[model samples]
Target: MTATQTKKALLNKIECAYMPVSDPGVSAEWYERVLGLKLRSPVKPGSGAIMIMGGGQWLFLLPSPGMTPLTFETTGWAGEGESFEMFPLCFETDDIAALHASLAESGTWTEAAVRDEGGCGLQLDFKDPDGNKYQAWQPPAQKGE
Candidate 1:
């Protein structure tokens, strides 16, 4: 331990995340129907919407004109020379298989298969109707369970 370093972190936890959408009302419904997020606020055509995730995190969808999807591209994550689209938001799930099935039934775009990332557990990447990329992770089961 360093004398200058404090044990307490300056930040507590991430309370919310914001994403740009073409229509807040439509996007809010998609989030609620496909991802099971609860709409916490009334959404008008031009107004923003607040959604509550299973873990109590807040996701705000704001209407923006000509807004790009909240995603970025990098090369090294997938391997050298292979570009990979990275998502700013990574959600946690308990049942990856069921979620995958649900996404499929909804006709959502997703990676062909769920990947086992070893110590990082199972992972699946998908996109919203607006093309906002997101990742879902299912932690590896505990040894005793």
Candidate 2:
């Protein structure tokens, strides 16, 4: 109960992410088959469906008339002259190599081969059926071997 003391921050974590898709049913199926997210509800033509990730986060795929994909380009992250297309969402994985192989076998659109990023560890970038860009990251192995 001091003046210098501040209350705890209200937000702790993100629970859900909303994405615009051309077709809810198709997107839902793609997520389930490709990324292993389970559909929480039945999909309708013009409606949205809730997809649950293994980490318990909900992804809502909503039908969009514009069909705009979720992605943006930035020069800041990649340095001054180079431009890098950033993925809004980055999912953590234990095995980046296996996931890369699976994505390739499925003919998914991946930016490039999985590479080590020093402090960031291994990273793989890929696009969904709707062209939404996303990244998968594998943390560096702990030192103790």
Candidate 3:
């Protein structure tokens, strides 16, 4: 197969997202109370918190020294000031408006309005207590909807 026509199998879906935070315990509680993420496991001696998304996807919050949230934003596309995205831990949402309102009322959301990416649906970015950035994305509808 040529370089542009290689017939390789596609990789499987993502199993989990590793989030670096200043404190695992505090971040875990914020994710639980604010984002409604249930605690899958407590912080271990050397490990971190494990949270489960709706579709059984795992989110691991590990401790890291001098860890900081990404400064740029994304809608699955390139833009100025955008970084490598080092895994922003995007959560798929069914109701972006409701989620946005809730996060806004909590006074923790980073942005005021959701970005409506024409074909990609809506997205809202927010940060945790430790400044770990995250996103909630609502995928576009399929044809015949």
Candidate 4:
């Protein structure tokens, strides 16, 4: 054997991703409808002064604990003030079509469509009205074209 790598990296699971919104409750409701994630609990109940006040692992609903929405100085941010950055949060799924349909059924998807990004992969994106973006992707086929 040589210095060449023999082992590989493996991943288990991703627990959550959180985003900030002006209102947590309302945002949570939207996520539940769009992504099919349940609002099981909150990291903090009344975190913001806003009506749907909360903070936890909610997509565009609330910030993660100790993490607020980005400010002007945050580095590597491709977005303008409150606009979506190029690097949006992505959710991986084997069933992109089903996910898109699920989102469409609820009518909460701002823009959910499937497109082929020049063999980057099969991808679909949906944006919440708040400007938060989420993506579902399937890798390019390794075995067959």
Ranking by lDDT: 1, 2, 3, 4
Considering lDDT, which of the candidate structures 3 and 4 is the better prediction for this target?
Answer: 3
Residue-pair clash count for candidate 3? 0
Model 1 stretches with alpha carbons more than 4 Å out? 1-8
TM-score of 3: 0.76
Model 4 spans with C-alpha error above 4 angstroms:
1-16, 42-45, 48-60, 63-87, 109-112, 141-145
What are the root-mean-square deviations of the candidates from the true structure over C-alphas? 2.0, 2.4, 3.6, 7.9
Ranking by TM-score: 1, 2, 3, 4
lDDT of 1 by residue, 36-139 (tens): 89999788656899999888999999988997999999886889689988898888999988888878878979888999988899999999888999999999
What's the TM-score of every candidate structure? Answer: 0.90, 0.87, 0.76, 0.54
Judged by lDDT, which candidate is best? Answer: 1
Taking the tens digit of each residue's C-alpha lDDT, what string does model 2 give over 29-142?
888887778999899666899999889999999999989899998987788769988899998888788788777877879856998998889999998888889999999888
Model 1 scores worst on lDDT over the 10 consecutive residues at: 40-49
lDDT of 4 by residue, 2-105 (tens): 68967665866544555666566666766666666666665366552122212233333554455343322334443554443343566666667777787788
Better of 2 and 4 by TM-score: 2
Candidate 2, residue 2: Cα displacement in angstroms equals 12
Which residue pairs collide in model 4, if any?
none
